[model samples]
Target: MTARPTKGGALYALPNALWLTFFFLAPLLIIVAYSFMKKGLYGGVENEFSLRAYALLANAGIVKVAFRTLLVALAATALTILIALPVGYNMARSKNQTLKLFLVIVPFWTNFLIRIYAWIAILGNEGTINGFLRSVGLISDPIHLMYNQGAVILVLVYMYLPYAVLPLFSTMDKFDFILLDAARDLGAGKLESIVKVMLPNVRSGLVTAVLFTFIPIFGAYAVPLLVGGKDGYMLGNVIADQVMKVRDWPFASSISMVVTFVSTIGVLLFLARQKRPGVSKEQAAALAAEAAVAAGGGR
Candidate 1:
Protein backbone atom coordinates (compact mmCIF):
# COMPACT_ATOMS: atom_id res chain seq x y z
CA MET A 1 0.00 0.00 0.00
CA THR A 2 1.12 3.53 -0.74
CA ALA A 3 2.21 5.32 2.41
CA ARG A 4 0.67 8.73 3.22
CA PRO A 5 3.05 11.68 3.44
CA THR A 6 4.40 11.87 6.99
CA LYS A 7 4.76 15.13 8.98
CA GLY A 8 8.32 15.42 7.69
CA GLY A 9 7.21 15.11 4.08
CA ALA A 10 4.34 17.57 4.57
CA LEU A 11 6.61 20.14 6.18
CA TYR A 12 9.56 19.49 3.84
CA ALA A 13 8.50 22.20 1.36
CA LEU A 14 8.20 24.90 4.06
CA PRO A 15 11.91 25.61 4.43
CA ASN A 16 12.40 25.99 0.69
CA ALA A 17 9.29 28.20 0.51
CA LEU A 18 10.56 30.38 3.33
CA TRP A 19 13.97 30.70 1.71
CA LEU A 20 12.41 31.72 -1.62
CA THR A 21 10.23 34.28 0.11
CA PHE A 22 13.12 35.73 2.09
CA PHE A 23 15.55 35.91 -0.81
CA PHE A 24 13.92 35.84 -4.24
CA LEU A 25 10.51 37.36 -3.59
CA ALA A 26 11.84 40.02 -1.22
CA PRO A 27 14.59 41.20 -3.61
CA LEU A 28 12.12 41.21 -6.49
CA LEU A 29 9.83 43.55 -4.57
CA ILE A 30 12.79 45.83 -3.76
CA ILE A 31 13.75 45.98 -7.43
CA VAL A 32 10.18 46.86 -8.34
CA ALA A 33 10.20 49.64 -5.77
CA TYR A 34 13.49 51.01 -7.00
CA SER A 35 12.31 50.89 -10.59
CA PHE A 36 9.44 53.24 -9.78
CA MET A 37 11.50 55.72 -7.75
CA LYS A 38 12.91 59.06 -8.96
CA LYS A 39 16.62 59.50 -9.62
CA GLY A 40 18.33 61.87 -7.19
CA LEU A 41 20.16 64.97 -8.48
CA TYR A 42 23.46 63.94 -6.89
CA GLY A 43 22.85 60.15 -7.17
CA GLY A 44 20.75 57.33 -5.78
CA VAL A 45 16.98 57.77 -5.50
CA GLU A 46 14.83 60.85 -4.69
CA ASN A 47 11.73 60.76 -2.48
CA GLU A 48 9.52 61.34 -5.52
CA PHE A 49 8.62 58.66 -8.14
CA SER A 50 9.23 58.92 -11.91
CA LEU A 51 9.71 56.84 -15.06
CA ARG A 52 12.37 59.25 -16.38
CA ALA A 53 15.19 56.71 -16.12
CA TYR A 54 13.28 54.06 -18.03
CA ALA A 55 12.34 56.64 -20.62
CA LEU A 56 16.04 57.46 -21.04
CA LEU A 57 16.73 53.79 -21.81
CA ALA A 58 14.40 54.09 -24.82
CA ASN A 59 17.14 56.05 -26.59
CA ALA A 60 19.28 54.43 -29.32
CA GLY A 61 22.27 53.58 -27.12
CA ILE A 62 20.31 51.31 -24.80
CA VAL A 63 18.45 49.79 -27.72
CA LYS A 64 21.75 49.03 -29.45
CA VAL A 65 23.15 47.51 -26.29
CA ALA A 66 20.05 45.35 -25.86
CA PHE A 67 20.24 44.26 -29.50
CA ARG A 68 23.92 43.42 -29.25
CA THR A 69 23.32 41.52 -26.02
CA LEU A 70 20.61 39.39 -27.63
CA LEU A 71 22.72 38.73 -30.71
CA VAL A 72 25.79 37.69 -28.73
CA ALA A 73 23.70 35.60 -26.34
CA LEU A 74 22.06 33.80 -29.27
CA ALA A 75 25.45 33.19 -30.89
CA ALA A 76 26.90 31.81 -27.66
CA THR A 77 23.90 29.52 -27.18
CA ALA A 78 24.12 28.28 -30.77
CA LEU A 79 27.86 27.62 -30.54
CA THR A 80 27.42 25.81 -27.20
CA ILE A 81 24.72 23.61 -28.69
CA LEU A 82 26.80 22.79 -31.78
CA ILE A 83 29.79 21.85 -29.61
CA ALA A 84 27.99 20.26 -26.65
CA LEU A 85 25.41 18.14 -28.47
CA PRO A 86 27.94 15.87 -30.17
CA VAL A 87 30.22 15.82 -27.15
CA GLY A 88 27.34 15.01 -24.80
CA TYR A 89 25.99 12.38 -27.17
CA ASN A 90 29.42 10.72 -27.35
CA MET A 91 29.75 10.81 -23.56
CA ALA A 92 26.27 9.38 -23.08
CA ARG A 93 26.95 6.53 -25.54
CA SER A 94 30.35 5.76 -24.02
CA LYS A 95 31.11 2.90 -21.62
CA ASN A 96 33.54 5.19 -19.74
CA GLN A 97 30.73 7.42 -18.45
CA THR A 98 32.53 8.07 -15.16
CA LEU A 99 35.74 9.16 -16.91
CA LYS A 100 33.81 11.40 -19.30
CA LEU A 101 31.85 12.99 -16.45
CA PHE A 102 35.09 13.50 -14.52
CA LEU A 103 36.61 15.28 -17.49
CA VAL A 104 33.59 17.60 -17.69
CA ILE A 105 33.60 18.39 -13.93
CA VAL A 106 37.39 18.77 -13.56
CA PRO A 107 37.37 22.33 -14.93
CA PHE A 108 34.31 23.19 -12.81
CA TRP A 109 36.08 22.17 -9.58
CA THR A 110 38.46 25.12 -9.94
CA ASN A 111 37.45 28.77 -9.43
CA PHE A 112 35.54 30.45 -12.28
CA LEU A 113 37.52 33.73 -12.04
CA ILE A 114 40.77 31.78 -12.33
CA ARG A 115 39.53 30.03 -15.45
CA ILE A 116 38.34 33.33 -17.01
CA TYR A 117 41.61 35.08 -16.16
CA ALA A 118 43.46 32.23 -17.82
CA TRP A 119 41.73 33.24 -21.04
CA ILE A 120 43.13 36.75 -20.56
CA ALA A 121 46.64 35.28 -20.50
CA ILE A 122 45.97 33.29 -23.64
CA LEU A 123 44.23 36.03 -25.63
CA GLY A 124 46.30 39.04 -24.60
CA ASN A 125 48.57 40.67 -27.22
CA GLU A 126 51.82 39.62 -25.55
CA GLY A 127 50.29 36.37 -24.25
CA THR A 128 51.27 32.78 -25.00
CA ILE A 129 49.09 32.46 -28.12
CA ASN A 130 50.64 35.55 -29.73
CA GLY A 131 54.14 34.43 -28.69
CA PHE A 132 53.48 30.98 -30.19
CA LEU A 133 52.18 32.54 -33.39
CA ARG A 134 55.26 34.77 -33.55
CA SER A 135 57.53 31.77 -32.97
CA VAL A 136 55.78 29.90 -35.79
CA GLY A 137 56.24 33.00 -38.04
CA LEU A 138 52.50 33.21 -38.69
CA ILE A 139 52.47 37.04 -38.41
CA SER A 140 54.99 39.82 -37.79
CA ASP A 141 52.80 41.85 -35.41
CA PRO A 142 51.04 40.52 -32.31
CA ILE A 143 47.37 40.10 -33.15
CA HIS A 144 44.97 42.41 -31.30
CA LEU A 145 42.72 39.59 -30.14
CA MET A 146 41.94 40.50 -26.53
CA TYR A 147 39.09 42.80 -25.43
CA ASN A 148 37.05 42.50 -28.59
CA GLN A 149 33.60 41.20 -29.53
CA GLY A 150 35.18 37.89 -30.54
CA ALA A 151 36.97 37.54 -27.21
CA VAL A 152 33.79 38.27 -25.24
CA ILE A 153 31.81 35.79 -27.36
CA LEU A 154 34.48 33.12 -26.95
CA VAL A 155 34.55 33.57 -23.17
CA LEU A 156 30.76 33.48 -22.95
CA VAL A 157 30.68 30.25 -24.97
CA TYR A 158 33.38 28.64 -22.81
CA MET A 159 31.68 29.74 -19.60
CA TYR A 160 28.26 28.32 -20.46
CA LEU A 161 29.31 25.18 -22.41
CA PRO A 162 29.21 22.82 -19.45
CA TYR A 163 25.79 24.15 -18.46
CA ALA A 164 24.57 23.11 -21.92
CA VAL A 165 26.43 19.79 -21.90
CA LEU A 166 25.18 18.47 -18.57
CA PRO A 167 21.47 18.82 -19.40
CA LEU A 168 21.97 17.40 -22.91
CA PHE A 169 23.90 14.46 -21.49
CA SER A 170 21.21 13.75 -18.91
CA THR A 171 18.46 13.79 -21.53
CA MET A 172 20.44 11.68 -24.02
CA ASP A 173 21.38 9.09 -21.36
CA LYS A 174 17.78 7.85 -21.04
CA PHE A 175 17.28 7.57 -24.81
CA ASP A 176 16.28 4.12 -26.04
CA PHE A 177 18.89 2.90 -28.50
CA ILE A 178 16.34 0.42 -29.80
CA LEU A 179 14.18 3.25 -31.18
CA LEU A 180 16.88 4.15 -33.68
CA ASP A 181 17.40 0.48 -34.46
CA ALA A 182 13.66 0.12 -34.99
CA ALA A 183 13.71 3.09 -37.38
CA ARG A 184 16.57 1.49 -39.29
CA ASP A 185 14.66 -1.80 -39.28
CA LEU A 186 11.87 0.04 -41.07
CA GLY A 187 14.34 0.75 -43.93
CA ALA A 188 15.50 4.15 -42.67
CA GLY A 189 19.11 5.14 -43.47
CA LYS A 190 21.54 6.17 -40.72
CA LEU A 191 21.03 9.88 -41.38
CA GLU A 192 17.29 9.41 -41.69
CA SER A 193 17.11 7.51 -38.43
CA ILE A 194 19.09 10.22 -36.65
CA VAL A 195 16.83 12.93 -38.02
CA LYS A 196 13.55 11.15 -37.40
CA VAL A 197 14.31 9.32 -34.15
CA MET A 198 17.35 10.85 -32.45
CA LEU A 199 16.47 14.53 -32.70
CA PRO A 200 12.99 14.04 -31.25
CA ASN A 201 14.41 12.08 -28.31
CA VAL A 202 16.62 15.02 -27.31
CA ARG A 203 14.03 17.83 -27.70
CA SER A 204 13.93 18.36 -23.94
CA GLY A 205 17.71 18.55 -23.83
CA LEU A 206 17.83 21.11 -26.65
CA VAL A 207 15.27 23.28 -24.87
CA THR A 208 17.21 22.95 -21.62
CA ALA A 209 20.57 23.74 -23.22
CA VAL A 210 19.22 26.82 -25.03
CA LEU A 211 17.68 28.21 -21.84
CA PHE A 212 20.76 27.49 -19.70
CA THR A 213 23.20 28.98 -22.19
CA PHE A 214 21.21 31.94 -23.48
CA ILE A 215 19.72 33.41 -20.28
CA PRO A 216 22.98 33.40 -18.30
CA ILE A 217 24.98 34.77 -21.23
CA PHE A 218 22.50 37.63 -21.58
CA GLY A 219 23.16 38.70 -17.98
CA ALA A 220 26.88 37.87 -17.89
CA TYR A 221 29.05 40.75 -16.62
CA ALA A 222 32.46 39.22 -15.89
CA VAL A 223 33.19 38.02 -19.42
CA PRO A 224 32.43 41.39 -21.02
CA LEU A 225 34.12 43.35 -18.25
CA LEU A 226 37.32 41.35 -18.72
CA VAL A 227 37.40 40.91 -22.51
CA GLY A 228 34.82 43.17 -24.20
CA GLY A 229 35.81 46.46 -25.83
CA LYS A 230 33.43 49.36 -26.54
CA ASP A 231 31.43 47.53 -29.22
CA GLY A 232 31.27 44.34 -27.19
CA TYR A 233 29.60 46.04 -24.22
CA MET A 234 26.26 44.39 -23.37
CA LEU A 235 23.16 45.19 -21.33
CA GLY A 236 24.85 43.87 -18.19
CA ASN A 237 27.64 46.39 -18.62
CA VAL A 238 25.09 49.18 -19.01
CA ILE A 239 23.16 48.03 -15.93
CA ALA A 240 26.38 47.89 -13.92
CA ASP A 241 27.67 51.25 -15.16
CA GLN A 242 24.37 52.94 -14.36
CA VAL A 243 24.38 51.63 -10.80
CA MET A 244 28.05 52.05 -9.91
CA LYS A 245 29.41 54.82 -12.11
CA VAL A 246 26.35 57.03 -12.60
CA ARG A 247 24.77 55.93 -9.30
CA ASP A 248 21.35 56.13 -10.93
CA TRP A 249 19.58 53.60 -8.77
CA PRO A 250 16.16 53.88 -10.34
CA PHE A 251 17.47 53.70 -13.89
CA ALA A 252 19.63 50.68 -13.04
CA SER A 253 16.68 49.05 -11.33
CA SER A 254 14.48 49.64 -14.40
CA ILE A 255 17.03 48.05 -16.72
CA SER A 256 17.36 45.12 -14.34
CA MET A 257 13.58 44.71 -14.31
CA VAL A 258 13.56 44.58 -18.11
CA VAL A 259 16.29 41.96 -18.13
CA THR A 260 14.49 39.86 -15.52
CA PHE A 261 11.18 40.12 -17.35
CA VAL A 262 12.67 39.21 -20.72
CA SER A 263 14.59 36.31 -19.22
CA THR A 264 11.49 34.96 -17.47
CA ILE A 265 9.53 35.16 -20.75
CA GLY A 266 12.29 33.34 -22.61
CA VAL A 267 12.47 30.57 -19.98
CA LEU A 268 8.71 30.14 -20.02
CA LEU A 269 8.75 29.88 -23.82
CA PHE A 270 11.52 27.29 -23.70
CA LEU A 271 9.67 25.20 -21.09
CA ALA A 272 6.37 25.55 -22.97
CA ARG A 273 8.02 24.04 -26.05
CA GLN A 274 9.32 21.12 -23.97
CA LYS A 275 5.89 20.16 -22.59
CA ARG A 276 4.97 16.86 -24.20
CA PRO A 277 1.45 15.51 -24.67
CA GLY A 278 0.34 11.90 -24.28
CA VAL A 279 1.34 11.28 -20.69
CA SER A 280 2.44 7.82 -19.55
CA LYS A 281 -0.01 5.61 -17.61
CA GLU A 282 1.82 6.32 -14.35
CA GLN A 283 1.74 10.09 -14.93
CA ALA A 284 -1.95 9.98 -15.85
CA ALA A 285 -2.77 8.09 -12.63
CA ALA A 286 -0.76 10.61 -10.59
CA LEU A 287 -2.57 13.54 -12.21
CA ALA A 288 -5.93 11.86 -11.61
CA ALA A 289 -5.11 11.35 -7.94
CA GLU A 290 -4.02 14.99 -7.55
CA ALA A 291 -7.26 16.12 -9.21
CA ALA A 292 -9.26 13.91 -6.82
CA VAL A 293 -7.48 15.48 -3.85
CA ALA A 294 -8.27 18.99 -5.15
CA ALA A 295 -11.89 18.02 -5.74
CA GLY A 296 -12.23 16.65 -2.19
CA GLY A 297 -10.60 19.78 -0.75
CA GLY A 298 -13.16 21.93 -2.58
CA ARG A 299 -16.03 20.16 -0.77
Candidate 2:
Protein backbone atom coordinates (compact mmCIF):
# COMPACT_ATOMS: atom_id res chain seq x y z
CA MET A 1 0.00 0.00 0.00
CA THR A 2 1.11 3.52 -0.74
CA ALA A 3 1.59 5.65 2.35
CA ARG A 4 -0.06 9.04 2.35
CA PRO A 5 1.79 12.13 3.56
CA THR A 6 0.50 13.64 6.80
CA LYS A 7 -1.64 16.81 6.54
CA GLY A 8 1.16 18.92 8.05
CA GLY A 9 3.65 17.66 5.47
CA ALA A 10 1.20 18.35 2.63
CA LEU A 11 0.65 21.88 3.92
CA TYR A 12 4.39 22.44 4.21
CA ALA A 13 4.94 21.42 0.56
CA LEU A 14 2.08 23.66 -0.63
CA PRO A 15 3.85 26.93 0.12
CA ASN A 16 7.09 25.86 -1.54
CA ALA A 17 5.23 24.54 -4.59
CA LEU A 18 3.31 27.80 -4.96
CA TRP A 19 6.46 29.85 -4.44
CA LEU A 20 8.35 27.96 -7.17
CA THR A 21 5.44 28.05 -9.59
CA PHE A 22 5.08 31.80 -9.35
CA PHE A 23 8.65 32.96 -8.89
CA PHE A 24 10.75 30.45 -10.83
CA LEU A 25 8.53 28.71 -13.33
CA ALA A 26 6.54 31.78 -14.34
CA PRO A 27 9.59 33.98 -15.03
CA LEU A 28 11.29 31.21 -17.02
CA LEU A 29 8.20 30.92 -19.20
CA ILE A 30 8.19 34.67 -19.77
CA ILE A 31 11.84 34.64 -20.87
CA VAL A 32 11.22 31.71 -23.23
CA ALA A 33 8.27 33.55 -24.76
CA TYR A 34 10.29 36.72 -25.11
CA SER A 35 13.09 34.90 -26.94
CA PHE A 36 10.74 34.05 -29.82
CA MET A 37 9.32 37.53 -30.21
CA LYS A 38 10.64 40.29 -32.48
CA LYS A 39 12.52 43.31 -31.16
CA GLY A 40 10.43 46.43 -31.45
CA LEU A 41 11.73 49.70 -32.96
CA TYR A 42 11.16 51.43 -29.65
CA GLY A 43 13.33 49.06 -27.56
CA GLY A 44 10.67 46.54 -26.49
CA VAL A 45 9.45 43.17 -27.67
CA GLU A 46 7.10 43.47 -30.60
CA ASN A 47 3.70 41.71 -30.48
CA GLU A 48 4.58 39.54 -33.48
CA PHE A 49 6.28 36.16 -33.06
CA SER A 50 9.57 35.53 -34.87
CA LEU A 51 12.86 33.62 -34.52
CA ARG A 52 15.00 36.74 -35.05
CA ALA A 53 16.16 36.92 -31.47
CA TYR A 54 17.52 33.37 -31.54
CA ALA A 55 18.89 33.88 -35.05
CA LEU A 56 20.75 36.93 -33.80
CA LEU A 57 22.53 34.64 -31.32
CA ALA A 58 24.33 33.00 -34.24
CA ASN A 59 25.84 36.25 -35.46
CA ALA A 60 29.65 36.11 -35.33
CA GLY A 61 30.14 39.08 -33.00
CA ILE A 62 27.53 37.90 -30.50
CA VAL A 63 28.83 34.33 -30.66
CA LYS A 64 32.36 35.55 -29.93
CA VAL A 65 31.14 37.37 -26.84
CA ALA A 66 29.25 34.26 -25.71
CA PHE A 67 32.27 32.06 -26.38
CA ARG A 68 34.58 34.35 -24.42
CA THR A 69 32.18 34.42 -21.49
CA LEU A 70 31.95 30.60 -21.51
CA LEU A 71 35.75 30.30 -21.51
CA VAL A 72 36.11 32.72 -18.58
CA ALA A 73 33.33 31.05 -16.60
CA LEU A 74 34.82 27.58 -17.16
CA ALA A 75 38.31 28.80 -16.18
CA ALA A 76 36.95 30.42 -13.03
CA THR A 77 35.04 27.22 -12.16
CA ALA A 78 38.17 25.08 -12.63
CA LEU A 79 40.18 27.36 -10.34
CA THR A 80 37.42 27.38 -7.72
CA ILE A 81 37.21 23.56 -7.78
CA LEU A 82 40.99 23.16 -7.50
CA ILE A 83 41.15 25.48 -4.48
CA ALA A 84 37.92 24.24 -2.84
CA LEU A 85 38.82 20.52 -3.07
CA PRO A 86 41.90 20.75 -0.84
CA VAL A 87 40.42 23.34 1.54
CA GLY A 88 37.23 21.29 1.88
CA TYR A 89 39.18 18.10 2.45
CA ASN A 90 41.18 19.79 5.20
CA MET A 91 38.09 21.31 6.77
CA ALA A 92 36.27 17.97 6.71
CA ARG A 93 39.17 16.17 8.41
CA SER A 94 40.09 18.95 10.85
CA LYS A 95 39.55 18.48 14.60
CA ASN A 96 38.78 22.15 15.22
CA GLN A 97 35.10 22.67 14.38
CA THR A 98 35.16 26.32 15.38
CA LEU A 99 38.00 27.17 13.03
CA LYS A 100 36.33 25.29 10.19
CA LEU A 101 33.01 27.05 10.75
CA PHE A 102 34.71 30.43 10.92
CA LEU A 103 36.57 29.81 7.67
CA VAL A 104 33.41 28.60 5.96
CA ILE A 105 31.14 31.51 7.04
CA VAL A 106 33.32 34.56 7.62
CA PRO A 107 33.54 35.51 3.94
CA PHE A 108 29.76 35.27 3.56
CA TRP A 109 29.09 37.71 6.43
CA THR A 110 30.45 40.68 4.44
CA ASN A 111 28.13 42.13 1.80
CA PHE A 112 28.89 40.55 -1.55
CA LEU A 113 29.19 43.91 -3.36
CA ILE A 114 31.34 45.25 -0.58
CA ARG A 115 33.61 42.26 -0.91
CA ILE A 116 34.00 42.86 -4.67
CA TYR A 117 34.63 46.55 -4.00
CA ALA A 118 37.28 45.60 -1.47
CA TRP A 119 39.05 43.63 -4.19
CA ILE A 120 38.93 46.73 -6.39
CA ALA A 121 40.51 48.82 -3.68
CA ILE A 122 43.26 46.25 -3.25
CA LEU A 123 43.81 45.60 -6.95
CA GLY A 124 43.59 49.16 -8.27
CA ASN A 125 46.60 51.10 -9.64
CA GLU A 126 46.93 52.83 -6.27
CA GLY A 127 46.22 49.54 -4.42
CA THR A 128 48.00 48.18 -1.36
CA ILE A 129 50.43 45.74 -3.01
CA ASN A 130 51.69 48.22 -5.59
CA GLY A 131 52.08 50.92 -2.96
CA PHE A 132 54.01 48.55 -0.68
CA LEU A 133 56.23 47.40 -3.55
CA ARG A 134 56.89 51.01 -4.60
CA SER A 135 57.70 52.04 -1.02
CA VAL A 136 60.15 49.12 -0.65
CA GLY A 137 62.05 50.07 -3.91
CA LEU A 138 60.62 47.07 -5.79
CA ILE A 139 58.79 49.03 -8.52
CA SER A 140 59.15 52.60 -9.75
CA ASP A 141 55.55 52.77 -10.99
CA PRO A 142 52.25 51.19 -9.85
CA ILE A 143 51.09 48.19 -11.89
CA HIS A 144 47.64 48.00 -13.53
CA LEU A 145 46.14 45.46 -11.14
CA MET A 146 42.46 46.07 -11.81
CA TYR A 147 40.53 46.08 -15.17
CA ASN A 148 42.24 42.95 -16.47
CA GLN A 149 41.45 39.26 -16.97
CA GLY A 150 43.58 38.19 -13.97
CA ALA A 151 41.81 40.65 -11.70
CA VAL A 152 38.41 39.46 -12.92
CA ILE A 153 39.39 35.82 -12.30
CA LEU A 154 40.80 36.67 -8.86
CA VAL A 155 37.54 38.34 -7.87
CA LEU A 156 35.49 35.46 -9.26
CA VAL A 157 37.52 32.90 -7.30
CA TYR A 158 37.30 34.90 -4.07
CA MET A 159 33.56 35.52 -4.45
CA TYR A 160 32.68 31.88 -5.16
CA LEU A 161 35.15 29.98 -2.95
CA PRO A 162 32.67 29.62 -0.10
CA TYR A 163 29.98 28.30 -2.47
CA ALA A 164 32.33 25.61 -3.81
CA VAL A 165 33.56 24.74 -0.30
CA LEU A 166 30.11 24.16 1.23
CA PRO A 167 29.15 21.48 -1.30
CA LEU A 168 32.57 19.82 -1.20
CA PHE A 169 32.74 19.87 2.60
CA SER A 170 29.20 18.53 2.99
CA THR A 171 30.08 15.64 0.69
CA MET A 172 33.37 15.09 2.53
CA ASP A 173 31.37 14.60 5.72
CA LYS A 174 29.93 11.45 4.11
CA PHE A 175 33.40 10.21 2.98
CA ASP A 176 34.40 6.66 3.93
CA PHE A 177 38.04 6.82 5.02
CA ILE A 178 38.08 3.10 5.86
CA LEU A 179 38.22 2.39 2.14
CA LEU A 180 41.38 4.49 1.87
CA ASP A 181 43.07 2.61 4.73
CA ALA A 182 42.11 -0.71 3.13
CA ALA A 183 43.58 0.40 -0.20
CA ARG A 184 46.79 1.51 1.48
CA ASP A 185 47.05 -1.78 3.40
CA LEU A 186 46.59 -3.65 0.12
CA GLY A 187 49.78 -2.04 -1.31
CA ALA A 188 48.44 1.20 -2.75
CA GLY A 189 50.64 4.27 -2.35
CA LYS A 190 49.22 7.47 -0.82
CA LEU A 191 48.37 9.13 -4.17
CA GLU A 192 47.11 5.85 -5.63
CA SER A 193 44.94 5.23 -2.61
CA ILE A 194 43.48 8.71 -2.86
CA VAL A 195 42.78 8.31 -6.58
CA LYS A 196 41.28 4.80 -6.38
CA VAL A 197 39.49 4.96 -3.04
CA MET A 198 38.88 8.49 -1.82
CA LEU A 199 38.06 10.18 -5.15
CA PRO A 200 35.51 7.56 -6.20
CA ASN A 201 33.81 7.77 -2.80
CA VAL A 202 33.60 11.55 -3.01
CA ARG A 203 32.62 11.75 -6.70
CA SER A 204 29.14 13.02 -5.88
CA GLY A 205 30.54 15.78 -3.74
CA LEU A 206 32.91 16.84 -6.51
CA VAL A 207 30.03 16.95 -8.96
CA THR A 208 27.97 19.01 -6.49
CA ALA A 209 30.84 21.43 -5.97
CA VAL A 210 31.37 21.85 -9.72
CA LEU A 211 27.70 22.57 -10.23
CA PHE A 212 27.49 25.04 -7.33
CA THR A 213 30.54 26.97 -8.51
CA PHE A 214 29.83 26.72 -12.24
CA ILE A 215 26.24 27.95 -12.35
CA PRO A 216 26.83 31.01 -10.18
CA ILE A 217 30.12 31.86 -11.87
CA PHE A 218 28.37 31.62 -15.21
CA GLY A 219 25.71 34.06 -14.00
CA ALA A 220 28.01 36.34 -12.03
CA TYR A 221 28.03 40.08 -12.85
CA ALA A 222 29.31 42.07 -9.86
CA VAL A 223 32.96 41.01 -9.72
CA PRO A 224 33.31 41.09 -13.50
CA LEU A 225 31.73 44.52 -13.58
CA LEU A 226 34.03 45.85 -10.88
CA VAL A 227 37.34 44.31 -11.95
CA GLY A 228 36.64 43.33 -15.56
CA GLY A 229 37.66 45.69 -18.36
CA LYS A 230 35.75 45.78 -21.68
CA ASP A 231 37.59 42.64 -22.81
CA GLY A 232 37.08 40.94 -19.44
CA TYR A 233 33.27 41.25 -19.42
CA MET A 234 31.11 38.07 -19.30
CA LEU A 235 27.73 37.23 -20.79
CA GLY A 236 25.91 38.43 -17.66
CA ASN A 237 27.45 41.89 -18.02
CA VAL A 238 26.45 41.90 -21.69
CA ILE A 239 22.89 40.98 -20.72
CA ALA A 240 22.78 43.74 -18.11
CA ASP A 241 24.15 46.29 -20.55
CA GLN A 242 21.61 45.27 -23.17
CA VAL A 243 18.66 45.41 -20.79
CA MET A 244 19.40 48.47 -18.72
CA LYS A 245 21.84 50.44 -20.84
CA VAL A 246 20.79 49.64 -24.38
CA ARG A 247 17.13 48.90 -23.51
CA ASP A 248 17.08 45.82 -25.74
CA TRP A 249 14.76 43.78 -23.54
CA PRO A 250 14.02 41.03 -26.04
CA PHE A 251 17.69 40.35 -26.81
CA ALA A 252 18.56 40.44 -23.12
CA SER A 253 15.75 38.00 -22.35
CA SER A 254 16.98 35.72 -25.13
CA ILE A 255 20.46 35.65 -23.64
CA SER A 256 19.03 34.95 -20.19
CA MET A 257 16.91 32.13 -21.62
CA VAL A 258 19.96 30.62 -23.30
CA VAL A 259 21.88 30.69 -20.01
CA THR A 260 18.95 29.06 -18.23
CA PHE A 261 18.82 26.32 -20.84
CA VAL A 262 22.55 25.65 -20.57
CA SER A 263 22.41 25.57 -16.75
CA THR A 264 19.42 23.19 -16.82
CA ILE A 265 21.32 20.84 -19.16
CA GLY A 266 24.31 20.93 -16.79
CA VAL A 267 22.11 20.02 -13.80
CA LEU A 268 20.41 17.20 -15.73
CA LEU A 269 23.81 15.85 -16.81
CA PHE A 270 25.00 15.81 -13.19
CA LEU A 271 21.82 14.00 -12.07
CA ALA A 272 22.28 11.42 -14.83
CA ARG A 273 25.87 10.80 -13.79
CA GLN A 274 24.79 10.35 -10.16
CA LYS A 275 22.25 7.62 -11.04
CA ARG A 276 23.46 4.28 -9.62
CA PRO A 277 24.02 1.23 -11.74
CA GLY A 278 21.15 -1.33 -11.90
CA VAL A 279 19.44 0.01 -8.78
CA SER A 280 15.79 0.84 -8.29
CA LYS A 281 13.41 1.30 -5.35
CA GLU A 282 11.92 -2.18 -5.83
CA GLN A 283 15.35 -3.80 -5.89
CA ALA A 284 16.35 -1.86 -2.79
CA ALA A 285 13.22 -3.00 -0.96
CA ALA A 286 13.87 -6.64 -1.86
CA LEU A 287 17.49 -6.38 -0.74
CA ALA A 288 16.41 -4.77 2.53
CA ALA A 289 13.97 -7.63 3.16
CA GLU A 290 16.69 -10.21 2.46
CA ALA A 291 19.09 -8.42 4.81
CA ALA A 292 16.43 -8.27 7.55
CA VAL A 293 15.84 -12.03 7.26
CA ALA A 294 19.57 -12.75 7.34
CA ALA A 295 20.05 -10.55 10.45
CA GLY A 296 16.84 -11.74 12.22
CA GLY A 297 15.32 -8.19 12.09
CA GLY A 298 12.33 -9.36 10.06
CA ARG A 299 8.99 -9.87 11.76
**Which candidate number would show the highest lDDT if scored against the true structure?**
1
Instruction: Give the TM-score of each candidate.
Output: 0.85, 0.85
lDDT of 1 by residue, 1-299 (tens): 57786888758889999999999999889878989889888986787777887898898989999998988998888998999888988998999999997788667655677778889999998889999999999988999998788899898887778777776777677888789899999999998997789888777666667776787788888788888977789998999999889998898899998889888998777646645763343543343333223212210
What is the Cα-based lDDT of residue 88 in candidate 1?
Answer: 83
The 0-to-1 C-alpha lDDT of every candidate, in the order given, reads: 0.79, 0.76
Single out the weakest 10-residue window by summed lDDT for candidate 2: 290-299
Which parts of model 2 are misplaced by more than 4 Å? Answer: 1-19, 277-299
